[model samples]
Target: MVVKPDWLRVKAPQWERVGNVKDILRDLGLNTVCEEASCPNIGECFNAGTATFLIMGPACTRACPYCDIDFEKKPQALDPTEPSRLAEAVRRMKLNHVVITSVNRDDLADGGASQFVRCIEETRAVSPHTTIEVLIPDLCGNWEALEIILRSQPEVLNHNTETVPRLYRRTRPQGNYDRTLELLKRCREFAPWVYTKSGIMAGLGETDAEIRQVMQDLRGVDCDILTIGQYLQPSQKHLQVNDFVTPEQFAAWQAFGEEIGFLQVVSSPLTRSSYHAEQVRELMKLYPRQRV
Candidate 1:
């Protein structure tokens, strides 16, 4: 593993704010990807009174090698009450924009799309003013399941193409690069009014050319937002780090992505899918949501 650089270091968490956020989640029995995935920006996000909620189980059906989420043989039954609890958390936190993601629940027929719908409905019912964004799995290529979630009409529909195509087999064995692209394409076709966003992680042995190609492919599907971040290995058991991409390179990629017509591009070493997500609201102002 490559040595973690100083730039990757972050200030210690503001425990007072983190404690408050944790109390809300713990009190509501809600989960968050920031805690589950061990995101490096958890302190900053939580301290700012913002967090990406992780629904479903902490365990995932697809055990991607580079991910920190646990893999389970068979998970428990979906919690029907989770949606209400999550809504209550949003209400208590007083968040204007909330992000809800889930572990891949391939065990269910609809890949847990119904649960997502319920969450959206419940959140909207409780906090009608909040804008929702969902970062979802591919639903095992079930376009029907994808449609179910899209029908809920989140402000942003984010699905990460976590790494380059060449590393797909090793890093994300159950994931198909073509399928990922097709999912984004279908989102545009099925819900042209919704803003489609995708993210990628670097430093997993992919070339800059491959990264640019991925950007081009996303643009081909009319993906509106792009985020690029450097991948950090979670543990010794996980995939080893291949490189630490420089901040300068990340800025160059952001410039390139914007030049190619992306409405918003968040690219940096520390940038994650939901980093500074509140800023995405600006897109709504730039291109107000239109009925299709």
Candidate 2:
């Protein structure tokens, strides 16, 4: 029998308002990771007035087993005007913080780096005071592409390790563990003034030691913010959950992360990488800037 954790049973506020948000996005003909990946926190995030914009296209070139994104043989053309449209959406939402991520476009020479830059420029043009966070891919470990994005200067540059290194083959077959570390390390190197962030999913058979090691690896890259959350299986084809991490365990991880010098750590059963991202930015503002 599959065990259901009590924490997952707690009632959350209704997110019917998200329907209105969805209508707005739909009328605009835009896609969101919250909707594409079927994120469990969509209701909470949307209800709280935040959303992670998905750009480039809905089809991802690389197929990660742990992810629920569709793999298209021939992905659609990049929208030249998506940045402005996204900026307009951000303006309409009146979001103080915005997170923009994209499907991996390995088909492009720059790996969608230019598109990221456009999104940043457009978002800043519209919402100058909004803090922008981007959850990015490894850019196929290309420093040039990564540099392009850093030059755009988002407030937070997040690239998820997703899971422990040992499960790379099963969880993210096309992804490289060391490459991801290099990506984060290079982000800090290229944009010393920008805050770096990364996240990992627990209950994917990652042990305490392994998770700790991942944290150390992230720190080695000079990552300033960290998020740890439980992995929920999106479909039968996706990776199954080995266990559901308890709220107390999540708290312990959060405390451990802070003790190890992470500026901010959000660890919980429902915590997603972009969850409470604005609050993370606010927390960082209280600290002394670290020399990159």
Candidate 3:
């Protein structure tokens, strides 16, 4: 087992505020990607009253070895009430920005695109001012399904590249690297107004060169935002950590991403896709794009 470096260690969060956020999520029966994916920043995000809401599941359709979310159990039926409850959570939390993500529901015909539309609409109904971002699956390359969600017009549409193309088969066996890039490219083509975002997890054996290439690929598709974070093994059964990237390297990637024209790049050891995601509200003000 590889030992974690001191820089990767997380600061303990204030339990009082953390508990308050948990209380609201439980009361409304909502799930968050922060908790489900075992994100190291859960405490800090919860303490600050922000969470990336995981809709359609705590269960996923694909069994990616690196992920902490469950895929063994039978997936549940879509909960029609989930969107309203999620909106209520936003209303109660008074979030200025909200992120809605989901497990890959491949069993559904549209890969749960309709559910995403409902969530966006419901959230808007309750909190019109809240900027919405959706971290979505590739919808099995179903561009039509993607269009359904894109039509809802969330402020940001995020899909993770997860790892470099060379690692896709081992790390994300079911995910297609070309298709992942195509999804982001199509998002820009279909909805020019929405900011396109993608993330990559470093330290799963990808070299610094490969990482930079992925950034270039994303930028080639006009991706507006990029986040590169270190990968942590969820458990012994999951994929083992190959390396722990240092803080300086993360800083270098941040600098490189910005130089390549990414409007925002959040890179660090503990930076998950949605870490400090609310900051995008300010990004919008600085580089606002009108709906096309």
Candidate 4:
């Protein structure tokens, strides 16, 4: 039986002009993970004047049991002008840091790698000093495709492990735990200057030992940043929450991540991978001599 976690109270103030912003996104035919994934921190992020853009397309190629994104055999064609439009949005928002992510576009030849590069270039062209980060797919373990994005020189490259290896068959059937580790390892190898990052969700029936093992695997890959957050079930159709990890448990994990040598660790009940991204970018800037 799955243990139901206590629903934490979230009473973020509504963004007054959020609907206008949503309309703009809809008008441009763009998708945001914040909307699609039902992120609880959407109001806070939008109110603070930043949003993570989901590029390529919203429909995913793989159906992870924990996700609510639609899995369609064939998705819409890539938007050639998306890069420019995203740049325009960033400029309009006056954003100094941006996070670009995408659905698993396994059908594309370059795995939509080139588009990722284009978005970075366009963002930089319009906002030269803006720090950019990308939460990329594993590309089905395609190193060449990953290399394409790394070459674009984003400040941070993040991909999520999502859950423990034992749960892969149930949580992310299409994903491979070992392959994900290899991907993170290669990111560090390809772009030594770029800060490599990954995330994992707790309260998925994973034992404490299992979580520790996942952290060790990440460390083996030289993952510089780590994020641990409670996994809330997206919907009834998705995986049921096994437990609701408490705030204290999250704090313990944060301390453990630091003890394991992660340069930065963000673990909290309300933490998502992209939470406080602006602050993360600012911290990156402080370590100028360090890798990007």
User: Top TM-score: which candidate number?
Assistant: 3
Q: Return the TM-score for candidate 2, rounded to 2 decimals.
A: 0.95
RMSD of each: 1.0, 1.9, 0.7, 2.0
CA lDDT of every candidate = 0.92, 0.86, 0.95, 0.86
| Residues forming the 10-long window of minimal summed lDDT in candidate 2 | 283-292
TM-score to true structure, per model? 0.98, 0.95, 0.99, 0.94
lDDT of 3 by residue, 1-292 (tens): 5788999999999999999999999999999999999999999999999999998898899999999999998899999999999999999999999999999999999999999999999999999999999999999999999999999999999999999999999999999999999999999999999998999999999999999999999999999999999999989999999899999999999999999999999999998899988989999999999985
Candidate with maximal lDDT = 3
lDDT over C-alpha atoms for residue 55 of model 1? 89
Task: State the lDDT at 13 in candidate 1.
Answer: 92
lDDT of each residue in 1-292, candidate 4, tens digit only: 4554455667765657676667667776777888888888888777777788999777889889888777854687988899999998888878888999999998988888999999999999999988999999989888999999998899889999989999999999889999999999998888888888899999889988898899989999999888888888888888888888888888888889889988888998878889887776656766553544
Q: Which ten residues in a row have the lowest lDDT in candidate 3?
A: 1-10
Rank order by TM-score, top first?
3, 1, 2, 4
Candidate 3's TM-score reads 0.99
lDDT of 2 by residue, 224-290 (tens): 9999998888888878899998999999989989988899999999888887888866776796455
Prediction 2 global C-alpha lDDT:
0.86
Alpha-carbon error at 239 in model 1, in Å? Answer: 0.5
Residue 82's lDDT in candidate 4 = 98
Of the pair 3 and 4, which is ahead by TM-score?
A: 3
The clash count for each model shown is: 0, 0, 0, 1
